[model samples]
Target: MLTLSIFAVLLLMLLIDIPIAVAIGLTAVVFFVAQGQSSFLAMLPQRMYSGTTGFTLLAIPFFILAGNLMNCGGTTQRLFRFARALVGHVPGGVGQVSVVSSMIFSGMSGSAVADAAGLGQIQHRAMVDAGYKPTISAAIVAGASTIGPVIPPSIPFVLYGAITSVSVSRLFLAGAIPGAVMGLAMMLAIWLMAKPRNLPKDPRANLHEIWDSFTAAFLPLMAPVIIIGGITTGFFTPTEASVIASLYALALGFLYRDLTWKEIPAILFTSLKQTCGLMFIIATANFFGWFTIFERIPDALITQLAAFGTTATGFIWIVIAIVLVLGCFIDGNAIFLITLPIFMKLCPLYGVDMVNFGVVMTLLIMIGNLTPPVGMCLFAVESFAKVGIWSLAYECFPYLIAILAVTILCAFVPEIALWLPNYVMGAAG
Candidate 1:
């Protein structure tokens, strides 16, 4: 009764528009109060501190800073030209460019919010300028932006690695194929819908134009290659890769003369603000996680599922459904931090492959970023496009289904998630 009550309070607060960090923190507080003890409340500070103290968690802010710097350094303009040069002749050319640009940006940012906010601004505006409906323009960008987390160098993957002791490198390799699948799928979906509408296309770029755009975009393009290559070849860890990314972006900012010394402090301040909010979520969610383990909540859940004779596959499907639904109302990382402890513990019993589980799990929760009512990506795109969330959600629905279908296929076919990692890492377990 007490456990259920805590969840009830949590869900109620989420539905009532409480900030996520507050909702999670309040839920833990409610749990303590309902437990009939102020003593349980005392554990909150320690748990919160421990949650954010890990060195691996440090990668989050560095990556965010790197992304912001690149965005501000005019990386988007170059990437856009390159994307348009390659795909602007395709059906729904502007929409196709949005999808392609998102895939390219993901390699650099590894953040859906960053992709949506930084690049989506340019992409969506360009789509609207191209005569696409504002809502549809926003929707296309929102759907494609989900790939940010699905791709390598993902912040969520790093968080998962830190929390569960999974190898971050393995997770990165695992995401590559799935991420590529999503990009290609989105483009194909665009083509089918685009040719019918006679969507506007850029005059096909001459070879010289393509070369010029590619050359101008070269350094920003190497951001992903450097991070992935360094990690894959064992030259550095993800944390070091993140630091490298920040420094590389800084270099390019100066090289391009797009960012000046006067702007440095502001960028750092913005990065700090974003990092603090994220850390607050991590801290508070850890308190909630602590209470969850103290109450043996995962055990309770597994036992109940067993009573219903839930098989391993059934368990995976059920988890996917629950996460998908919860995703509609909450943030993705918050969901991961809250629910992963329970799911990780259950995986062993169900014979779930941890690498595959972690990869598919990231992809599934990320879809929520594109969903309605509270999708972070949806709202981000909506703000700039000046469109309604429902309208954007409606337009985004097909692309959403396309990505989710790939996600389900990934869940059923573990090789899709594991083969690359295993082949690359030499038998990832």
Candidate 2:
């Protein structure tokens, strides 16, 4: 009865369009108070505090700052030049550039929204000028941006690690293969879709031009290497790597004269706002997660699913179905925060490696970023490209299928997600 009531109230809140964090916090409060467990209220503050106060949580702000610094310091443009030089001569030239840029940018900026906004401007304009339809341009940017969280330094991975007690480094390593596969999938989809149209391609850059662009982008390109290398080598924790990333960005901005003093305040303010929003959601999720455990929801789920033959593959399919469906309506981050605790309890029973599971979960939720109604990246790309949302959704079908294919592959062949992590960690050991 309590579970029903809690879920009913959550559904009501969702229907009324309440903020997810507020809805979660309020629902937990109402459920606990109704149970007459007044003492449970005391757990709320602790949960919220512990959630935000983690050493891993420190990485969130630094990463946001680093992304901001990179954008403001002109790194994004330089990366764009390098990407265009490589792929702009291909069929659907700008579309290919968007896919490649998103892959590279993913290693630096973990946010899909950031990737869409940053790259959408350049890619969308180029596509339109080259005579591609606005909807197709928007679709490509939206689909490509989803690659952000599948790559290393992914914010979703950090959140998953913090919530699930999994190793973030291992999760980062696990993402490498899947991320590469997804990028290739997007490229293939674009090739097929654009080939019939004979989309205009820029002439390939000469060797000297390619070298010039590479040299110009080298510093920004190395940002990911420095962060990932430091973490893998035990030179620093992920949190420390974030700090170093921020410092590196700051140096590039100020010392290199890329970002001006006048821009510093705006950049910091924007990053802080994003940080606060993310932190609030994390804190509130902690409160709701506590209530969930107190209710034994995960245990209830396991017991109930046991009646239906709880084989490992069956359980994974069930989870994938649920996440993919729910992902259609909710933001990926919200799904991550809300469902992670539930999965953490259930995964061990299925012999699932937590790190590999985290990678799959992150990739699945990221798919939501391209779908309808509430896909943040979809809205971002549409707004940037001035494309109609419905038309963009129509154009996104092929790339969506590509993403679904990659999701299923990663789901069924866990080694695809686990190989790099296992190899790297084995060498280290």
Candidate 3:
């Protein structure tokens, strides 16, 4: 009943349009005061500070900056050109390009909103020009953007590793195959719709064109290879990889001359704003997470689940259902921060592997960005889409199903997420 009331208040605050960070902080404050535990408020400052102090957490900002720089530095466009060269001639040509391009960009940005807002403009424009419907074009962009975080170099995976003390390198490796699976599934959906919907088909590029496009994107393309290789080879940590990624992106901005020195300030400012918002949420949500642990919420949940003989698979399904429903109403980061403590405890009891769960959880969280009511990717695409949110949401259904299928696959077949990590890291402890 206590947990119910706290969440009820949190949900009410979210419904009323309160900022996620503030809403969480306020809910904790209100409950503490009401319970005559206002003394806990004294630790607020310390807890919030300590929450943002994790070394792994340092990667978040650099990754965000790297993504911002890449977006502004001609990286996204080159990736799109290369993707189009490879698949632009297929049925649902432009749509296929959007998915493939997002997969490539995902390897760098590790952010759905970045992909949606940055690559999305190019994709939506290209699709519209190629004769796709405006609504479908927007949906394709929004849906494809979800692929960003599922690939390597993911911000969510970094945060999950920090919060859970899981291996960030393993998490990065774990995402590789599932991300590819998502791209392929989305492409298949587009292909199935091609004939009936009369999706456009562009002329295939010759070998020379493909070679030239790849060469154009070669440097930017190296971002992921450098990141994954450096980590797997024990050369650098994920946080260091983020710094290298940012530096590389900055170099590309100048080398290609796509981003001028004057643009650097604006790019840094944009990355700063995003990083600050995310950090604030982390700060407050950390306090809220502590409150849940203090109240023994995980203990209570474990008791209830045990009473029902819940299995690992059953636990995953429950989490998926909750995440998908709450995803419509809450930001993915908030949901992650608030529920992580409770979920982490259940992992061992249910025999679920943390590394595998990390990938699956990250995939589910990104799916939230494609959902309506507060879907960040939907709004990002809608900014240029000019289509009603509902219409865009409607069109995203097929791609959503495709992603959810991959998520379910990961949850059930742990090997899907764990195989690569185990192969490279010699199995996670």
Candidate 4:
């Protein structure tokens, strides 16, 4: 009866188009009120407060601010120049630039939506002018943008880590390999598709031009290295690393004379607005999570699943299948926050390492950003590039298959995800 009621309320809220965070919070409140549980009501505020007050969560705002700062401070243009020199000679040169720029920007920004919005403007115009199809250009930007969370300083990773109590530092390390693999996969797909079409390539830059772009992008490129290096070396926590990243971005912008005093207010305002929206979602998720716990939903799920098998590998594949289906509907972050506690409870039964699980989960969530209905990156790129959503969706099939193949590889072989972190950062303490 309780489960049915909860679902009903959830569906009702969804039909009305309430924000996900609000729907979750309201559903939880309705559940508690109906049960007439006084204790649960008392616990709600504390749970909500604790959920939003984590020291680890401080990284969210810092990273958001840093990304905004980098975008505004000329990092995007420098990286674009570097990408063009490196890959602009290929068929669909500017198309390739979109993919490479997304890869580079992933290290700094971590949000696919931001990547699409920021890089889409530059890449779309160039690709259109070069005689590429608008749908192809839009599809490329949307597909490439999914790479953001796979790279270090990933916002999704931080949120997942906080919810599941995994080490954000180790998750950052784990993402390095998979992120690179995804980028390569996308590049290969583009090369194959674009070659037969005889798409135009940008003239190869000479040595002086290549060297100039490289030198200009050098500092911005090092932003991820500094943050990841500091965390892995025990010099600072993830929160502290975020602060360092912001400071570093600020320094680069000031030194490069890219960020003027006039731009400071706009930057701050943008960061603050984005941060508030994200943090509100986190806070509301906290309230919803409290209700989930009080209802014993996770424990019920564990007991039921235990009836099948207890092995880590089996449980992982099961969860992956579930997330993929869910990905077709829900936004990635909402899925993460709502389902994390359930997964965390199940992890111990399978003896799965939370750090490795974190990486795998991040990959799966990113896949969602590329798929249909509610894919954030897909919609953003399609709208901006003025391509029909259906056409872009059809074109994305091959890329989807390639990404699924890589995801399956990561799932079966945990070493691909964990090796770099262990080798480069040593074991997490």
Candidate with top lDDT is 3
Writing each residue's lDDT as its tens digit, candidate 2 over 181-248 gives 99999999888777787777789989988999999889888988998888888989888888898898
Estimate the TM-score for candidate 2: 0.96
Better of 1 and 4 by lDDT: 1
The lowest-lDDT stretch of 10 consecutive residues in candidate 3 is: 420-429
Ranking by lDDT: 3, 1, 2, 4
For residue 423, model 1's alpha carbon misses the true position, in angstroms, by 1.1
List RMSD in Å for every model shown. 1.3, 1.7, 0.9, 2.2
- Across 1-429, the per-residue lDDT of candidate 1 in tens digits comes to 655777778889999999999899888887677678668898888999999999888889999998899888888889998999998987889898998888888887789998998999999889889988777788888988899988888999999998888998999889999999998888888888886766677778899999999999998888899999999899999999999989998999899899999999999999999999999999999998888888889998888889999998899898899889889888999988888888998999899988889887888877888887879998888878888888888888888888888989899999998898888778934
Q: Write the per-residue lDDT of candidate 4 for residues 237-282, one digit (tens) a residue.
A: 9889888988988888899888988998898898889888887778
**What is the per-residue lDDT of model 3 for residues 1-429, given as tens digits with 9 covering 90 to 100?**
888899899999999999999999899889999999999999899889999999999999999998899888788899999999999998899999999999999888889999999999999999999999999999999999999988999999999998999999999999999999999999999999999999997998999999999999998888899989999999999999999989999999899999999998999999999999999999999999998998899999999999999987789999999889889988888888988989999999988999999988888887889888999999999998999999999999999899999999999999998999898889733
Sort every candidate by TM-score, greatest first: 3, 1, 2, 4
Cα lDDT listed for each candidate: 0.88, 0.84, 0.92, 0.82
* TM-score of each prediction: 0.97, 0.96, 0.99, 0.93
lDDT for model 4 comes to 0.82
> Judged by TM-score, which candidate is best?
3
Candidate 3: global Cα-lDDT? 0.92
| RMSD, candidate 1, Å | 1.3
Where model 4 places Cα greater than 4 Å from the true spot, the runs are 1-12
